[model samples]
Target: MFRSIVKQKIPFLDLKIQHQQIKNEIFQAFEKVYENTSFSGGAFVEEFEKDFAEFCRTDYAIGVNNGTSALHLAMIALGIGEGDEVIIPANTFIATAWGVSYTGAKPVFVDCTADTWQIDPSKVEEKITPATKAIIGVHLYGQPFDVEGVSSICKRHKLFLLEDAAQAQGAKYENIPVGGFGEMGCFSFYPGKNLGACGEAGGITTNNKDYYNELQRLRNHGCKERYYHDILGYNMRMGGLEAASLGVKIKYLQGWNQRRKEIAKKYHNGINNPAIKMQSQPDWADSVYHLFVIVTKNRENLMEYLNKQNIFPGLHYPVPCHLQKAYTHLGYKKGDCLNAEYLSNHCLSLPMYSELTDENVEYIIEVLNAYDDE
Candidate 1:
């Protein structure tokens, strides 16, 4: 039992430690922005977008103000609207469903696979209706959803496929990256993401030329010309400063993802306890392990024990999107998405940043095993 001598102690996510490592380079990035005072979308943002597109193996990339904005713009470009419906997994951040709502489309909630915590592609076809215009497949918790299966369904049904790659930036399915798998991929650059910005930022990736251009227009003030207006577009431009910060982080995403994979592998192999089970990986997914969540029978007690030891953990979602107050209009009751609702209660994310030390991991496991013995 460790007690803090100085009172204040260890952190769940130490951005100070992370920022210290890249201080010089990050400072220079900020200096360039200050020198130019180019805050809005410009050369800096464009360069980052191009670099990110190549990273995702997509033909084009559009930088936006935030991940939610990216999702909304992607939906708009697909011409999704009031009469149309978008199918989304119930086990995701509210932003996923909200994006569909932003386009004046109804989001149809679908269940997730018990094993992978991702949208169950096998169940997708059953939900398809004449009003189904698109499918927003989410790669939840850094593991890529079954893209091949969902893609086949969409192709057979002639529906658009959008990849919500917010948490799966470096994750892959069978050697292909997640972003390039669907028609368009939306990413978030919130401060805690795998490749985060200093503040809010996001990007979209696509291979289709027409969709890409229309998305570009949608991200701007919906104008193809500098001064002309067109569709009802949201001002979702990614700032130059955020782009610059993200650029520095993007260069290290591969390395950081590799580290996260190593930690996840350790967690999978360690913590020998039957009362708790780590999130399982799909056979085809080359997951980046964005969050090493575990399902536990004694979730509340385990969380309390970890907290007592200063081992801060996170609950990815205590409430599923469909059950949230904002989405009560979806008309889904408690038992509707049982798997998702159950997972929300049992699923808990361990401290999983790239900077987490092996000693700390071992300590966490040791504490977990000790608690399990009780």
Candidate 2:
């Protein structure tokens, strides 16, 4: 008689497990928001903004509806507009480019570092031009980029520096948090992020009071007082419910990030396949491992094999921004950003979350090792 083997199914991200862990806290926060009818920006949002600002070690934080809105407002507040060019790494999510586009600015693409998957600071200077106005350094996969190099370049060139810190919440470089390193640091609190809210939410951290006040106005229809407008702005204010939930989650971010680090360490030490290339972590970076990605020439085959075993994974980005159809008018071709293009094809995100179990990690490692043998 032949016996049937049942493979254990592992999800790429298990938000349900995380929710279960904080169910009561999330419920109570929602209850408070409902009771007070503070649906729009209110005390809940204000409290979270202050708490998050302290967490990022910044003097102020302004909450917005989403990360894209945060980036857009930051660009607008910094005076990035038509005829301006902003340099961004090509390997990041398309929203980074969208932010620049929303401000009527051109997004100049730069290739990421092959090992770190971050914006190559060495390649940045060559891209700077007379029209260049700002540089948005993205902390991809929760790892902080080379802040000192980028900061120095920004200082020398007299360009504004922004941190697209969507994936990096608790990450640090040189023992300092990433969000406070630049003029403005943007964050996303999507349900899956390191410091997630119940729904969509984002915020910006800054030490400059002027920028902080300007962002607050930009997010609230350009109104410092009721029925008064200084500049045309979007209604991009964050909701009270999302802020309340985020306030609860913020208290647990460090612990959750630590758990993610432990999981990443296990993957790094156990997955000994020569064909698989792991991301290099610099000594100065303390990454939170948002999505533990591995690069392999046989990515498609490996992904298929893992799926058959009921172990689902994900792709951070399968297509670089330059090659996306939406950006075709930018006149970029396939090889314009070679490193980012290569990473888009080779990268594969493993199942990584704070709730991922030890048994699952072992099973994944075993399956990967078996695939290497095959």
Candidate 3:
């Protein structure tokens, strides 16, 4: 018998509800931008950048068009280019690799730890060589990777460390926030992220003033003064309209992140299925639970069961970066990154938004715990 304890459908993500709560505030912010006519990179974007820098506990934050552009600009500012290699985890979204590829640098893949599903620092050193210029440590799934471990390796090898903090807006490692952990950190304010803008937006955070200046110029067509181009650059600047919306959303980020954590705790404590596995959190890292993922060998069956109960889940990624067709020229094989491949096959993301109701969570747990693929 199919259990229908919960009558309402639970979506994997409901950005609409989040927008409704702050609709008026968002409109007001937009009105201000409209009145000032700061449609492009102007006062509104500058204000949000300042606000974001303080929130991340960093000295500066440079706003950009999107997360991918933020990464690309950072790599350019760091002088990463053709023939250079940047180490990245294989289990990440392709945008992480895009940053390196855009700069004509090769992205060397590393396997994630089996338990934490984060870049395994143990595997990083083996991939580094004379051609390696930097290491982009992604705080995958809103959890901080082994910062000390990765930082130690960077120090020993004299490589630049960049934090891909797109999913970890409020996450921290040992009480220090993620964005300021490396030489530069990149963030995305995609509509579904914890602190999302109304439209596309992203930022780079750093303490280095020189990197800050370069990033600003790079994002705005390589010019500090109007119409005086210093170098070749793209039109990757963030709009004032998107930045204005982000300013309103940033205030409630902590509270929303806390609710996500509460839901994750319920899932952890309630699910008793023998076949299911979850990412293990480290003591030193505080995760914001951007995606509450569970791994099961019987993913297809579990997904079908959840769908029948009017619960729609999601997949963070079904393919690892190394296995993507775009990277085929790099000559990577299936068994190269075993951990990432296993996760790509087995991972399932459940409904994980701040707006997820308690009844929805309990019903999900009920359905999951009752499942028996045997």
Candidate 4:
């Protein structure tokens, strides 16, 4: 059965209602694109890049097809290639690992912080080597990773720092946005993201002139002029349509993120069950609560019970990248990634979005508490 008809049920990341609210504005953006017939990189994309770069407090923001492509382009722009190594957290989505692999660089898996589920800064130096060229820090669940600690480690070892800010559109680390701290930051605008566009879209932000210029060329067949390929490149440009939609959505991002934070605060204070552990934030960081996840002992049972009540939840990285069959060449055996394994088994995402009704959130918590009461 379809979910919209179901009454009083919390659905995980409802884009339908969100889209409904902004439909007219979104259509106007599309209409502008249709009027100009400028479907590729044009005024819309450039204006969005400028606006987003300003929002992220970076010198440049280069739009692309998806977060994966953005990451790939960053690695390419940085000239990280075969025989190189890129260290990344084992707990992130597979795209983080694949992005490194896309450039023929090896992915060195690092352990996660038990509390934050981000790359443990203390464990970073141990993974560095002569081949370790870059470190990709993922801001998991819209929480900023420890950029201060991570950047210090990277500087000491002379490694590039890349921010996977896919889930962290409005997140901040010590009053600075998550993307601003890294050498380059990549953001995804997939429908489920906090600052989602109408479809798959992403961008890279950077302060380096070389990287910013290189990213522009990299996304457009390595050409400043049409039909020209200066270097080997791929087609990963963000369409004008997507950019138009994103530009419209970008206007409301901060307010929506604030709303998400409000919802997370409510969830934090209201879920009084011992069986569930809410995701905690560090004092120095401000998370946008993209997922509103929890750690539960009986996660599978809780998921099924919620689903029975027409409430749908989400799972971010049910399997860690290090343990995947494709990455078996990395020789990661079971228990090698201790914290990631623990998180993979225990983490479960609750219904979280800008439009989540208060009654639905309370009722969802009630159901979980009732389950625990048993």
Error at 272, model 3, angstroms: 1.4
lDDT of 4 by residue, 50-147 (tens): 99999998989999999999999999988999999999999998888888998999999998988888899999898999999999999989999989
All models: lDDT? 0.86, 0.92, 0.93, 0.88
User: Best candidate per lDDT, number?
Assistant: 3
Q: How many backbone clashes does candidate 2 have?
A: 0
Ranked by lDDT, top first: 3, 2, 4, 1
162-279 in candidate 3: lDDT tens per residue? Answer: 9999999999999888999899999999888888889999999999999999998898888999899998878999999999999898899999999999999999998999889989
List, in order, the clash count of every candidate structure.
0, 0, 0, 0
Task: Name the better of 1 and 4 by lDDT.
Answer: 4
Query: What clash pairs does model 3 have?
Result: none
* Model 4 stretches with alpha carbons more than 4 Å out: 1-6
Number of colliding residue pairs in model 4? 0
Clashing pairs in 2: none
Q: Model 2 compared with the native: what TM-score?
A: 0.97
Query: What is the TM-score of each predicted model, taking all chains together?
Result: 0.96, 0.97, 0.99, 0.96
List runs of model 1 lying over 4 Å from the truth. 1-10
Give the winner by lDDT: 2 or 4: 2
Per-residue accuracy of model 2 over 106-223 as CA lDDT, tens digit each = 9999999989999999999999999999999999999999999899999999999999999999899999998988889999998889998888999999999999999988999899
